[model samples]
Target: MTEKYRERVCNGYDHVLTIDERLYDVRTDHQHLLIFKNRAFGRVLALDGVIQTTEADEFIYHEMMVHVPVLAHGSVRRVLILGGGDGATLREVLRHRTIQQAILVEIDPSVIDLCRQYLPNHSMGAFDDPRATIVLDDGLHFLQTTHERFDLILTDSTDPDGPAEMLFSRPYYAACKASLAPGGVLVTQNGVAFLQLDEVRSSARHFNALFRDWHFFTAAVPTYAGGIMAFGWASDNPELRQQEATTLQRRFSQTGMTTRYYTPEIHRNAFALPQYILDAIGKTSP
Candidate 1:
């Protein structure tokens, strides 16, 4: 039999992975969902022809996204996560003993259900935690209407296209900013900087206008098909992004959490951007 393969083409880059087994393939009301097993990545999930997450390196992305802001704030009691239906982000947030509530707003219920069933390790029973509140609504609507405020907000949505196009807009970012408590921080999955420079540039512009401090951080996820992935960071408190490594280490130690890819050193260094990337995002420095 011929080998099966899947190719993800984005921003002039093509990433092809061999499919060792076909698990689930369906078109939900909102988007197409595909899950397959690969020799290198274990279980792979793709939404709307874009690679969302894989078992091998999910820790890298999820840990950096969740821990950086949470640990930096050092007193985050409430967290709001938008569009992380896969639950990895929630899992990371719930690891912090300081977190009292974690509300996840996802537009499509199918993504949550199917991901829980098919990508069980991605969530690892996070959906069943008592501290977790799952809301089946559009993120922007939830942000606009919710009275609750969070110490940290994470936008784990897909790329800026199709169902998620509005998420990367200025209004959506403004809504997220409004939903934050004082000293709160907002982090977004801003796509890979090498190919998706415009996405970072747009978010940077919005953050510049909205927050007292704004910057981008870098992480390398093998399946994301770009040189380095950038996470958008914005906050009214500039000091949150300037925490000393010792302070972050103290906060991390108190949580008693073990991470694979995230450390105080890594968190501190992620903010150091290359000149080309800084130029692309229209910033000279962090």
Candidate 2:
């Protein structure tokens, strides 16, 4: 029998991946979840008709999300991750030897189980790491209630729509701000700036109000179906992203980390935004 697949339209891109096999399909309380295998992207996970991550290039997305900030910060102990149910972000966070604790707040537990079973490579048993604690609840509510502080908070969430809409809200950004320790940094997956201009602009406005310094960077993820994926960088310290090239290179070398898409040079240049994007975000400079 021949299996059929459907097209998912997101950010004005029509994405259609061949489904060699469907591993799971269910409607969770939050949204529809689907896991399937394909030749191009290998094991694929999609939520609410939008592709989340793929086995082929998942490293590119996860590495950039984790290493850039960790390297920029130089050292971190406590970390919080929101909306990354697949555990990929957690996996990368635990790579830092300085990390003492990692708290992951995922609204949907099913996403974790399915990803564990089907997308094993994405997480690579990161859930069972001694440093990780998985919280199955609303991220906003957790942030509002938790008294604990973190050195880094990474919102590896979906696009600014559906269940993830509040993750990008001003109040949520404020909560994230309050949840962080002094000198802490917060990063977010801001989607493709070329297509989702409103998301980038709105996020920039809120971040600018809350943080002393806020900037953005880009990474080219083939599966994301856009020119480049933008990551949001915000912190009270203006010097965090402006680390000298020599310092960053030295720190990166000490970590003994290897990445497919992220390098010291890329880290240095990621913040170099194009004029159109700066204009869209109402910024005159990088």
lDDT agreement with native, every candidate? 0.91, 0.89
Model 2, runs deviating above 4 Å: 1-12
Total clashing pairs for each candidate? 0, 0
Residues 35-148, model 1: lDDT tens digits? 999999999999988889999999999999999999889899999999999999999999988789999999889889988998999999999999999999888889999999
TM-score of each: 0.97, 0.96
Residue pair clashes in candidate 2: none
Looking at model 1, residue 260 earns an lDDT score of: 96
Question: Which residue pairs show collisions in model 1?
Answer: none
Best of the candidates, TM-score: 1
Error of 1 at 46 (Å): 0.4
Candidate 1 displacement at residue 110 in angstroms: 1.2
Deviation (Å) of 38 in candidate 1: 0.4
Backbone clash pairs in model 2 (N, Cα, C under 3 Å; residues 3+ apart or in different chains), count = 0
lDDT per residue (tens digit) for residues 1-286 in model 2: 5464554545355766778988899999889999988888888899988889999999999999998899899878999999899999999998778899999999999999889988888788899999999999888999999999999999999887788989999999999999998889999999877877778899899998999999899999998876788999999988998999999899888877777787899999989999988998778873
